[model samples]
Target: MPQGPGYATDLADRYDDWFAPPAATTDATVALLARLAGSAPDGPLLELGIGTGRVALPLAARGHDVHGIDASTTMVERLRAKPGGEKLTVSIGDFAEVDHEGEFAVAYVAGGTFFELRTQQAQLRCFAQAARRLLPGGLFVLDAHLPEALAAHAGAGAQTVETANGDPVLRVRRLRPAGQRYTSDYLVFADGLFRHVRVDFRYASPGELDLMAAAAGLRLRERFGGWSGTPFSDTSGYHVSVYELPA
Candidate 1:
């Protein structure tokens, strides 16, 4: 099992309030996912790291049977408490290694969570697992930021993001190019208290990810700069990539 404190059980209570919020980009992402799912041939949809049902809930509401896997039990419990969350079948375990019964029409990981695997080998395992769980010609999608863009922030940096009520949260980050990793420490002050959180990510180039997919028996199908079907180019800062298993 993958061991980590970054996504521990304690973080579940604040996970949604801290990260899940409706935005124009969020709408676009769901729209794109729903569109891609429409091509699937009647099977359950699988979400890797389905935190608090942010995307899964909305997709389930659209009449799709959605299942998910996450390492954090607390997060899954919180998801179960939501109004439509109970409709989702979630297993609490590391998505990269967990085995869920039944083949799926589509499997996806959003918010660059794929990088949370920490190592290239782990990521490969995740791809292989997704391919195993998907039916032939089934889709495997990923949403991630381009690592090339992080070159602009090669050193230490800090940014302050405010909440809906104007409460400020400061994020301090550092980049290590040699390891292709980024570390972030967040200081949040809300409800008259302060909380600290830290997260680490290992990013990979698009080509590297494509190679991993190929090793997992998946073939690249589509690549977009954004969820709106924007063409991917050298200037693109993020990507929504789709792959398919051989039929």
Candidate 2:
């Protein structure tokens, strides 16, 4: 199993401010996820890398019972400080090997966090764990970057992240295709602070992820370019894939 990425102390403090999406985007994400999850009577939801409760908190607010497993206590601490965050049942550990007392209606890993496992074997284990956590016929949702899209800008690039009220922040990234990994650094000019966040990904293609899910007894149900049901295409940058366990 993979070890920890220490976000609690370093990145946890600045994560929400630096990476939080606009309220509209967040609402869309939560809406799509909640819909895919179906009714709450199906089962509680499980978030594999529920960071700072960005998505999880809203789902909880919508009256879904949310359980999460994460490697960073600092991240979980920030989550616990938020409203409704305290009510969540969270475990501090490797999500790839995480277990729960009961099955869930949905098991999801959002924002490309699944790629952080860094090895195909580890990613496979994560799929297996997710399968085990979900009830039969339940869904396992993944939001991941398209390998083709990342290949489009394999070497280096910069992106602008701005909220309606906040100044623009620059994000720089470099992809090393040899190992199928990348690193990102954030330049927050508004705060006059330079925060560097490095994420390494084994970067699997959609087919590879599907095979892993199959090995874990899950099958693809739907795939889209975005949360609003955009058709997946070669030019799309990211994908939201939904997989289902057999009934």
Candidate 3:
């Protein structure tokens, strides 16, 4: 229900380059997700916010049918331009409300995209939709950074960093603890011009997320600090959580 300056076409074109050094995380992410995927079922695997097929294409290469839903047509178009990308069935729409045929054995969102939904109600709707899209006992996986770190920086105003590509980017963030919302405004200098993008995130603690998943008929099954299966602890920066629908 909440939307802002979502992934723009220009930003989509530079996404891969901006996140270069994909080898650092992409391989591990795909490997762990593939393991979690287990044996392929009759239904295709589903990826929410499947940006540029970063994880989906690799999974599809492993012979599992893969479908994706994303709100960015530019991102989907970039995915389509890749080798073997044409094999994927990607729909352009909000992953939270998009309708896809058949049930999925596994559904996931990577890179903290789950937090992009700016309201608890919308997030709950997403969980319900995922439950409806999955077969009984199907898996739902989420990868997100903990809010504790951001909470530490409440009302810190603007910060800037230079990308590896020599672009200077400025970020301004405001955190609202009462609603567990974090809003970010990014200004990126590229091609001798500056562009702005705004993103609002609704973050939940692990326990809160479990409750939301339960409301949607999913039970927590597994959780880890990272892709290597490290145990989650208070000091952990991010978490990968898996939930299951009742069989």
Candidate 4:
């Protein structure tokens, strides 16, 4: 197993503003998926890499039976602090190794969390594990940058983040694909206040992800270019795919 990434420590430190799942993004994605998964007000939904409940809390509030797992304790703790979060069951451990004793109606990994795992084997293992977590026919949704987009936008330049409270932070993500995986790095700075950086990895296209899912015994169900159900184009920023385990 890969040891902890230094980037995770940075994510832990910025638990409140940066790492916590943003409600707006989560709500939109979940709403779309709820319809896709045929979710009722009551859903037995599962989320992996449930960082700070961005998507999980809202899904729970919408009355889904949401369960989540994350590798970060700080993220899990922060998640429990949000509204309607008291009842959520969040595990603090490697989601890859954790034992989830039940099958869900739907399972999801959102907000580019898939790319953070760092290796093709690790990424593939996640798909295999997701297959085990789902009930037969349960949907597993994944979102990440498409390989085609990388060629179109080599090292898709700089992005900065400013917190609601204090200092501004400049963070740049570099996306470089080798074979079927993306090697990435995040250079972060607290504007002129503090400067720190981390290097990491993200992965390739939906086709690569699908191959992993296939090896794990899950079938491709659907795919969209974006959360808005945009048609996938070679130029789109991501490939959002929904895979289903055999019923």
Clashes of 4: 1
Q: lDDT tens string, model 3, 1-247? A: 2222365455777766553224547788888888887843456789988888888898899998889988777888889999999889888777788467779989998867899887788788889999899887788899887888776655566777445466777778778888898887878887888788777789998888999899999999889998767898878978999999878
* Candidate 2 lDDT, 184-247, residue by residue in tens: 6667655676655555577888999999999999999989998766888877899999999888
Which lDDT tens digits does candidate 1 get at residues 1-247?
6543454566677766564544556678778888888886678899998887878887888888999988877788888999898778888778887478889999999867888888888899999999999988899999877877665543436777544346567777677878988876778787899988888888898899999999999999999998878999988988999999988
Which 10-residue span in candidate 1 carries the lowest summed lDDT?
A: 1-10
Which portions of model 4 show Cα errors greater than 4 Å?
1-13, 19-24, 39-43, 151-156, 161-167, 179-192, 197-199
**Root mean square deviation (Cα) for candidate 2:** 2.1
* Ranked candidates, highest TM-score first: 1, 2, 3, 4
Error (Å) of candidate 3 at residue 30 is: 0.8
Provide TM-scores for the models. 0.93, 0.91, 0.88, 0.84
Model 1 CA lDDT for position 141: 95
**Model 3 lDDT on a 0 to 1 scale:** 0.80
lDDT computed for candidate 2: 0.81
Q: What shift in Å separates residue 63 of candidate 3 from its native position after superposition?
A: 1.9
Where is model 2 more than 4 Å wrong at Cα?
A: 1-8, 39-41, 163-168
Model 4, range 207-226, lDDT digits (tens) per residue? 77878889999988778887
